[model samples]
Every structure is written in structure tokens, then in C-alpha cells.
Target: MNRLALLAAASALVLPVALSAQSPADPIFSPAAVRAHVEFLADDLLAGRDTGSEGHEIAARYVASQFDGLGLKPAGDAGANGVSWFQRIGFQKTEFGQTPATLTVSGAGEAKRFTHAGDVLVGLNAAEPHLDVTAPLVFVGYGLENKRLGLDDYAGLDVKGKIVVTLRGYPKGLPSEEGAHLSATKGKIAEAHGAIGMLSFGTLQSMKARPWARMVQMADEPDFTWVSPEGVPFEAAPGLRASAALNDSAAQALFAGAPTTIAAIRKTADKAGGKPKGFALKTSVTIRADSVSQRVTSPNVVAILPGSDPKLKDEYVVLSAHLDHIGVSPAKAGDPADKDRINNGALDNGAGIATMLEVARAMAQSPDKPRRSIIFLASTGEEKGLLGADYYARHPSVPIKQIVGNVDLDMPLLLYPFTDVIAFGANHSTLGPIVAKAVAPMGVKLSPDPMPQETIFVRSDHYMFVKQGVPAVFLATGYANGGEKAWGDFLGGAYHHPGDDMNQKIDWDAGARFAQANYRITRAMADGDTPPLWFAQDFFGDLFAPDAPKAPK
Candidate 1:
């Protein structure tokens, strides 16, 4: 009766095959752990967790301590022996001091003082004792000074301490043969001309993609603090620099008042096929700036689970998630959502951090460790143009060559039940197929990137590794599975807004499953014999071609 009864009970419980486990001994990802991590990281107490703030520091310490508790080896700074896990990455912070800036223009016998915050704007250049400029204004076409192209806007004349005014954007289309020869390039070319300040026309419209522009705007207001990239501590010649975009009407008025406008100057320069006699304007801007500079330190949390194989243990697999967010948003618009204020960044990255932790925990419980090392990096300042990852890639604890694959987990909140995963850089690299093979048995379909026009492949933290010739891939929810409303609801409401708070509306259970799938993929790469690679069609494919091979299942 005992054997018969036990057999009968087993048969009854396992009748349906789809519900049974693949292997009883296999390690399964723990959803409870992932939820716990996410809840804490996305908590209101974190205060939206903006980088370079006290809130950001608190999050960094928590992550570092977690790495320490994981019993993972240090893989940060490098010494004579090998490498350490903790590296000191510091940046010099700049503050626009309380010095008021004033702009004065004496045209038509009118001398008026312009306010810096409202009427005028200025930034720092070289750190000199002072920036006194009375040089004549020369209208340089985009200010390109490429020696290779035989185009030097300042070839005939001097612009060392002068003010240069330039047009914005690449012209409507390809330039004429003569125009191309002059090498009128991007905006950065204008800054290299040794001009005290540049008045940029029609360029501010493109500032939507620039963090510096946005930060400057916020700094003008009294309620919020602006955080910029850490410069090299102090400029060798820090001076007052002011730039502005003159509207069409404004440009017309300036041209009419000056000896020559940008149009007439360009016409003359083009006719000579070189720098023509320059025209000067009777305009001077008096910029009195108050600014401060200081050194700031931040850390990238690194924890590693060493591999078991004698041959491949030295190689590495990186699982990364940015621990930092945009932090608190200033309350404007007088709406309740704006008052919500905290850009808690639940989906932007708290989800990725929790997923990485869950994956690490699951692998730690496995019967066998991965063949190659698994490194978990909670990088900082991702919203600040991937600064932390960029810094780490250049100063990697392990040899960049030993890194086979990098899986960056970002924005995994809205998972679909039946749809394929939106795998980025799939076509750009061979890792796409490897990912597909790993998820196939789980009955999950893989989908090509649906929003190619967005050029999302170049965005996110993974791109940093990719830039260093490593194969990196990231997955996010796709709009193909859900209706327009569902897609819009998630992105439109919480993408980066204050409404991205921790509410029960998030499908945590589904998110946990997605995290588990990523864990399995990471495990496969970590233990496999072959490394992932960029596809032949990808722009970076040649960089890793020598080591590229079919990833082992």
C-alpha cells in the first residue's frame, strides 16, 4: 500500500506536463527576492535618487556594502599584483558663483545693461585671471577650422580675444565643392577658434538632446540645483563665456547695424575661396561671473562570483544595471503630478538593479558555478551620459579582452506574456542568436527591434562596453505586444516623470519572470565554451572579429 499510494500521488500531481519543472535539481530564480530589492530601491525615502546628491551617495554605499556582503572578490583598482574591486573615480564639480553677469551694447549711441539670467547667458572657458574682450565681431560660417580640408575661418585674420558669431546646424544638404573645402563643420569647431565667446544662431533648438542645456535652464530658476559633468577640476584659463541664438528678426537687426552680416560675409568668403577681409561690429558684452569648482568622488559597485572551470575561469561575463536615477524633479506646472516631484525611476533602472541581484542570488544557489566569472556592476551617473560605465571601461579591473559578453538590464517593467523580447543590437551582433537559443526552450519568442528609427541601439549603459569592442545586448518591453494605450500609459506617464512612483500598478510578477530569463542567459554565457560577438553587419563587428565565435548553448 505504501509504494502504490506514493506512486499514485506522484502521478496525480504531475499529470499536466506544461506545469512541471524541466529538472527538479535546476535552480529557479526567486521572485520574492527581486520584489524585495525593487521595493527598497524605488522607495520614497531614496528621494528619486539623483546622481551627485546625498541621496545618490546613500544608494552607492548601500550597493557597495551589498557587494561586500556577497563575499565577492574586489575587481576595481589595479595594482602591481593584479586588480582591486574598489576604484576612486572623482570629478571636479563647477558652480556658477553669485557674480552677476552684465552685457552692454553701444550701438546707435545706446548703451544698455543686459541681465545675465534673463537677457543674457554665459559659461566658463579657460581659467584666466580675467576675460576682457573688445575684439571686432567676425561672422564665421559655422566656425569650422579643419586644416585637413584646407578650411580655416581665421586663416587671414586673428580671433584670439575676439567675439565670433556663427550659424547653427549642418547646412540643408551637402555643401558645394567650395563649401566642403572650407570645412565648415559641427558646432564644436567654433569653440576651438580661440574666440572669447560665440553667439550661436539657430542651435539652441537642438538642445533638447543635451543635458547641459537642460541643466542650465533649471539653474536659472531658484527652486532646483543643477548638476553638470565633472570637468578637469579647473580650467587652465577659466574665463567668462557667453553664447546666444539670435532669432531671424534679431539677426536681421544686428546685420543691419553692423558693417556686415553673416550672409554678406559668407558670400564674400566663398567668392575668394578663402578667408576674406573681415568686418567688425560695435558690440561688447560685459560678463561678470561668480562660479566655484570642487572635487567630487563617486564609486561603481562591483561584486563577482568566480567561475569553476580551470581553463575559462579567468574570462568574465558582466551583468550591469545603473543604480543612479534623475533623482527629484522640481515641482512646476502647479499640477499634483508635478508636486509628486520624486523621479523615483522605478522602470528606468530600479527594475534592472533588482533583476541583477535576483540573478546573482539564483546562480549562487546552483549545483555548479559558471565556468567563467560573473561580475555584477551597479554603475552610477548613467543619466549623466554613462559617465560611470565609460570611466570603468577605460579602467577595467579585468582585461577588456577577457570580457566575452555584457548584458545590460534596463527598463523591464512592462513585460508581455506571449510576445517576443525586444532584443537590441541583435542584427548588429551574433549575440542575438545566442540569446534566442537560450530563451527558445522557455517558449519565448525573440523579436527584432521594432523602433529602429529611434536608434536605441546606441543608447543605454551597454553601449559603453560595446564602444570598447565588447559584445553587449539589452532587452526592453515592445509596443508590438500591447495596444497603443498600454504602451503609452507606461512610457508617457512614468518614463521620467514624477508619476514614476512605487505604485501597485506595476506587474511585479511578470517582471520577476523576465529577470529570471535574463539570469539564465547570463548563466549560459558565463559557463559556455564560446564567447558572444558582434555580427558581421554591425559597425563594431570588426573590432571583436578575431575572438568572435558561435556562443555555446
Candidate 2:
């Protein structure tokens, strides 16, 4: 009877300790706190938080203050770097206002006037007015220049000092056979040919069938970028414009009285059957752009949790999340009243920021401190071309060689009651094995990338670290075959839209559990002695030396 009583006492003693370990991480991720931050960030008061805008300044300051309150060390020296954790990036913001743009073809019947902000686009092609081109027009099929394909769009034509109108992507299929044969990289060839202005035809019949067309094309609104194709930095290149869908239709109308449609002409070229005939339609286009240059400040909020082990503490594990969004879109396209002006970006990234915040707190309070430094980075300007993360990768507060893993969070949705986390780039790094080993008992399946062509591995801020030889993981909710509509409903509604508001729809309890999971996973990595390495056959294997040690099979 006495021994039985002792056994019962032992059982009672362990129960409280076990329950404490498995208890919910609610204290770390208070719904009130998460909602407060999300609501403030998504609020219209920030005025769409465009980079270099007043709203952007307010957001940056708020983030920096949070980092300060967290007692983070100044990652960048203020006087030496002329920036706080708040890194100031240099960029030119050009404002193009709508005025009247007149286009008159000498041979065409009438002069057409396109009002600024309505029917036409105007922007500075270069630093000066010398980029203005008033020349004859030449239509180039896809603007591809490749010797391997035995076809150069600029082959029998001189585009110098002329306006070159080019079609969009080449037809699908292999380089061999009747399929369209063109270099995958063709943007450089367009600029090299001395085409004063190149207008990309966006609306083709095939493009309409693409599932991602809706995401890429904002209806009725023209998206403009001075960005050149990769490998072709025209340092002094002239104006580059992506024509509206209407512009493509207008170009097609030019061959109206011809015997063949543009589509048929391209098909003929693909088969190498004959030279598709070209017609000269009197074409004249004028673009005026107002360019504004300004100096702006955004921040990368970083807090470090010093490790228990002295040696390993010098090395680090980074947790990153972009704190910027597309800001806001103009109202002319849809819902003129709201003006598409508020891009609250609740899911695109607001969730990511909140995750990092909770993870920081939870890991800090854990019973066992990590062996290596844990860095929580709130990066800025990810929407503006991954500028903040790129800068952090180049100018790291910690030694680049010492950073073992980069855990970058972007999109986080409600967790499935019984499913694995979807980690892209898992197979791309040596850290994958460690992660796999940790989640094994959790029933979390390590998945190889199902959508490789999307190049999602290289899309987020994590790519910046991976490119620099740091092993990284970009985690998102696992994909379920039956959840298409639910996925679409969540993403399509709030993604870069004004309706992305903070509401009860978000599963805060699940979000907190996910954050706890992240904290545990990262802690497991940081507390270990072995640092993760670049995986073999991961495309970036060359980033490590050829003789480098490989991850265990």
C-alpha cells in the first residue's frame, strides 16, 4: 500500500512538468497583440506606405522603435553608416503626370491625341531629353536574338534610331521541331540592336490562357518599369515600355487588310515554311515621363538572442520577413471610389512580420537557450525589388561565413489540423536533413519541390541569402489538392488588394501554434554544434568549394 502511494505521488509530480512543456504558446503570440500590429500596419493611415513616401517613413520608424524596445543591438553604426538599423537606400522616384500626348503618323490620315494618365504613358527614358525618338516603326517577332535557334528577330533589319515593336514570349515547346525556337534570354538582344524604344506586346491569345495571367495583369491599369532584362543593363539605354493589351490589339489592326493574322504569321515562321509578310502601318507614338529623384529611409529591424555556448554563439541563425508591400494601386482600374489605394497586404507579408515577432519572444523565453545567436530581421522594400534583403545580404551585421541558416517567412495561412509544413528549397540545402530529422515524429513530411519552374526557390528574400552561400528555408502552408478554392479565396481577395483588412477570419490560435513550431525548429538548429551547409546538386553547390563536405544521405 505504501509503494502504491509512492507511485501515484511520482506520477502526480511529472504531470505538471509535462503539461507545462506542451502547453499552448499563447503567451508568446497574443491575438490582441498580433491584431493590434496587423491593424495598425494595414490601416489606411499609412497611406499605402509606398517606398520613399510619408507613409513608408512612418512604418519604418514604427518598426525601428519596436526593435529598440526589444533591446536589439544597433546592427549598423549610426554615424559610420549614416543609418540606424534603419538603412537608407538610394533611388530615383520618377513621377509621371498625365498631360496630352500627341501622336501623328506622316502617312496616316489623322493625328491622334492621347491624354496623359488616360490613353497614354509618359516618362523620362533617360537622364535627359535626348532619349526622345520620332522615327519609323519596325515590328520584330518576339525581339529574340539567338544563333542556336537559327533565327534573329533583328536579322534582316536595322532597328537603330527606330521604334521596334516586339511580340511577347515565344510559343511553348522544345527548341527542336515546329515549336517556336528562341533564346530563353532575349531581353538583351532587343536593347543591343539599338532600338530607341521597345514596346512589349503583352496581350496575346496564348497569354490569356495562362493561369497566372490574372495575377500579373491588373485590369485596365498600365504597369510601367524602367527595369531592363537580366544581363542587359543599358546604363544609357533609351525608353522601354510594356504596351497595354489594347496596344497589342491596335498593332493587330494595322495588318487588317493583310492576307494573314499576326498569329498565323508567327505559326508560319515557326514551321520554317515561308517568310511571313510584313505590312507598314503609319505608326507614331509619343511618351512623356516626369522623373522625380528623392532620398528615403527604410529599416531592417534586427534583434539578437545571445546563445548559451560561448563559441557557437558567435555563429548565427537568421529569421527574416519582409515588412513592405506593393503599397497601393491607383483607382482608375477597378473600384474608382476606393481607387485601389489601400494595399493592406495582410497575407502577402503582414502575417510574416507578426510571426517573427512572436518567434523572437518564444525562443528567448525557452528553458534551453540556443547555442548560436538567433537573429530576427524585419526587412523592408521586399516589394520594391528585394532591396532591403539584398542590402542585408551584402552588408551583414554578422560575418557571412558564420550564418548557418536563413529562415525567411513570407506567406502563412491557417494550418491544417494534421499536415506537414510546405518548405520550398528543402532539397536545396544540407539543413534539409536536420529539419527532416526533427519533424519526423511530428508526422511532417519533407517534400521535394512540386512546382520547380515557378523558380519560387529564388523568388523571396531567402534567395538573397542562398545566393550568398547561406543555407535558407522558405516555409509556407502545405498545399492540399482539395483546397484550391479555399486557397484562391484567401490569396485572390487580399493579395495586393485594398480589401486585405484585419478581421476575425484569421485563425490566431493556429497562427500562434505555427509560430511556436517555427521557434522550436529554429531553436533545434541553433542549439546544435553542426552548422548547416549548401546541399549538393542544389544548383548553388558551386557557391561552396568543390571539395566541400556533403550533407549526409
Candidate 3:
């Protein structure tokens, strides 16, 4: 390709035409290699690559080997037994110690025990394996305690050593990031109030977005938390001993003899500035929690490509993809999909990891090395609430301050010929234009997040980096050119199911294109003069990176 060419036009205008240059991914990508990586990782022998399982360990080593073969430097923890490519993470898995964990509510000479899941769903007690608690129930509205927002549902309530009932989500209207942060911190709030237990029921708004049946379907799944170095799980919330999610029926049962009915509470919550007050309920719930926990370790396969420029070499850019998936579908009869037990996350993340590996290969081998260092983090435990990325962000091998940006690749829908890609959180930072530039050469436009209501900005691994004040974006194919239906179908059917295997119609060329686009983005972020920065006064930037640099508005 010519860097510059001149053509004489009919109107006597001499125009300089710039020929199409090779994409960063095209020169280094192999469709066959991409397919082969997914094949090996998604194989039945890997058993769905569950975190802390032997299969995920094998998957981590496989990624490390790929890095080693690509000549990338080891960038993990230095350990005596394990190699430096492995950042061994500690995890605790909890399963039901005794099934049919019962909840009995009694008050005012009336007792009701909801045994079926239709009324309530009992969660595994990951903090304490064996637990039994009978505490007075108090309705604390939404259980929020933010004084700055002038919202304090626990102001006049005495919930010390008692069970506090709350709504599932924050109020209907709040800033997206703040509301998301508040919604995720309900347990800590309960613990801070000296509450012994908590019960959360869905609100009308929340249930409309996500149905109750979906929650019950996943009630039997195990719970996991990352254990700290001291062997205690972070934020185990010791004071909050037992918890349960109630359906409408169970919520109504709790207010059986109380001052206000659950129906009235729901109705009040629906109106603007109309909220239920914190009040002592006439009921007491006896919760029996019997669960078992075990400590296990998994690794984040970390590797780096050294930078070329001396000054910028100290700065770093990260590329991340989760290597773990939900191990296997629980055995269920009469379903042919369940007959194949293994939940081969070929797209859920097998494809994402494969893309990262190829991008790492390209970056490491490219003659035009990037100015800033590039770290390829094949993370684990993403299926379990982005634990691995959180650990990496909080305890990075590299200096956290030097990590300029992160690009997360997770579950790129590869079933269609996508003309545009959505980079979640891109608009919040300088990465927005950078992303547009990177994918433009591939004839792919950068699209806005189609489903903002999903709050997908904080759902994936990159959001962990964002919380650490690093500018980050989660890149994936957008809903265009048959992508809408494809995404809907895959998420509805094969997502985390056994059907996401190599048997699907995976467009390898699309995979190659996606990998190439990411490579260009990583390259641009690494070699560009200015490090990525939060857009001026962006919500996430102001929330997480207030002291960090910001790009001009």
C-alpha cells in the first residue's frame, strides 16, 4: 500500500489519495488460530473452566503458554512453587450444607412458614456455614443510608440485632452510577446498622425488568467470594448473619400483622416522593442457614509486552478477558440441552480470551512496538461477579497509578456480520474517539450502548479498572445487521448453556475482525502521546477518578 498517491482529476485538480493500510489485526491474525483456541478452551475436557477447578487451572496454564510462545514477559506474582505467569487468587466456594433451608415467620399469634421457592428463595450463607437466627423484623423502606442524598430510611428505626426488610434496588430516579453503587452496597448498609439479618424483596420496577422466575431458576447455584490473605472473605458482613430474597407472597407474609401491608408499601414506592417509613414489624423470622465453604486458588495469567519508548514505558495499558465460565449445568431431567451437561462458554468468554491471545501475539511481534507497556490479563472468576478483575485492580502487579487504561473483551456476539461495535464506558472517557479511530479502518463504527437500562457499564471486568480510576471500556459487537436477534437468541438460549460450543455457526472472519479492531485500539492507546483520560466531569470519572486527569470537554 502506498503512503501517498497523486491523481489528476478531470477538473484539473491534483488529489493526493491515501491507499488503504493493513489493519493491526490483519497482519497478525489467523482465523484458524482463533478457532483452534476456542476449540481447545471450550472442549468438554475443560469442564466449563470453573474458577478454582482443575479445568480453569489448565486453562490458565494454556494462556500462559501462549504468552510464553509469543515472547511476552511474565507479569504475575513471584512464587516459590508456581511460575511467575500465575497470579494465584484465593477464593472460597460455599454450597448448601443442608438443603431446604427453612424460614418461619411468626407474630401476633399467627405463624406462617414459606417452604416453596414461589414465596422466597434462601441464599447460601457464604460467611458462616451453619447459622440459625430468629430476630425481630423491621421494615426499613429501601434500607438506604445516604445522608448527602437526604435519604435515610433508617433514621428513626431501631434495627440493632434485628432483621431489616428492604427493597431490592435503589429509588427509581438517581444518577446511574450513584444509584448502581448504592444498589450494590445494601448488605454493607445493613451490617453497619448492627442488624443481625436482612430480607430483600423485589420492587415493582425491578421485577418488571427482571422477572422473579429467573431468580428462582438460579437459586440452587453455589455462592463464591474472594478470600483475603487472612483467610476472611472481604466484606463478609459478619453482623448480617442470614439473608433471603422474598417474592410478593413472602413479603406480604412478613407484614401479616404489621401497621402497613406489603401491597400498600409497593403502591407507595411507585409514586414520586412517596416512600414507606421505617417501622417495627410485628413479625419475627427464624432463619436456618446450613452451608459449607472451602478455600481454593485460581490464577490470572498475566503477561506483558515491553514498550519501545523510554519515557512512556513506565505507563501501562491493559487488555483483559475472563478465562473462567460457569462449570456445568446442574443435572436436570427432560431437557436435551442439559443432557450435554457442560456449559461450554465458547462465546461467553472462550472467544473473548482467544481474541486477547491473538491481540497479544500481534502486539508483541509487531515491529512498531507501542510506547507504553501492554499487559494482557486473562482473568478468572468473572462469572462469579468479576472477582478476578477486582483482585487484579486492587492488587495489580504493576503500579496502579501507571495503568492508564483498560480494554475488556467479554462475550462478543459472533453470530452475525456486525457493522458497528458498542464500547461500553467509552463515551465517559477519551477512549470514545480512540475507539472510533481504531475500528474505523475496519469499516466498523463505534455505537452507543443500546441497552443503557441494563447498567452494563458496571457489569464487566473493565468496570473494575474504572473503579480504580483507570479509563476503561468494554468492547463488543453491536445490535445491527442481524445482531439484535442474534444477541437476544444467544443470551436467551445458549448463554451459559451447553449449546455455546464449537457446534454453533461462529463466523471466524468476524472473530478475526473483532480481534483486529481491539489490537488497533490497544496499539493506539499505548503509542498515543497522551494517556487516556476521563471526559470532563463525566459521572464515573468524577465518582472514581476525581483527582485524576480529565480530557477537555
Best by lDDT: 3
Ranking according to TM-score, highest score first:
3, 2, 1
Give the lowest summed-lDDT range of ten residues in model 1. 11-20
The lDDT values for all models are 0.61, 0.57, 0.83
TM-scores of the models, in the order given: 0.69, 0.70, 0.91
Candidate 3 residue 239 Cα shift, in angstroms, is: 2.6
* Candidate 2: worst-modelled 10 consecutive residues by lDDT: 11-20
Find the 10 residues in a row with the least total lDDT in model 3: 1-10
- Angstrom error of the Cα, residue 368, model 3: value is 0.7
CA deviation > 4 Å runs, candidate 3: 1-28, 80-83, 116-118, 146-150, 271-276, 334-338
Backbone clashes under 3 angstroms, per model: 15, 6, 1
Q: After superposition, how far is residue 13 of candidate 2 from its true place, in Å?
A: 29
lDDT tens digits, residue span 400-510, model 2: 877878888896765233245657677766667766665555455556554443446667888778767788888766655323444567665766776666642776555
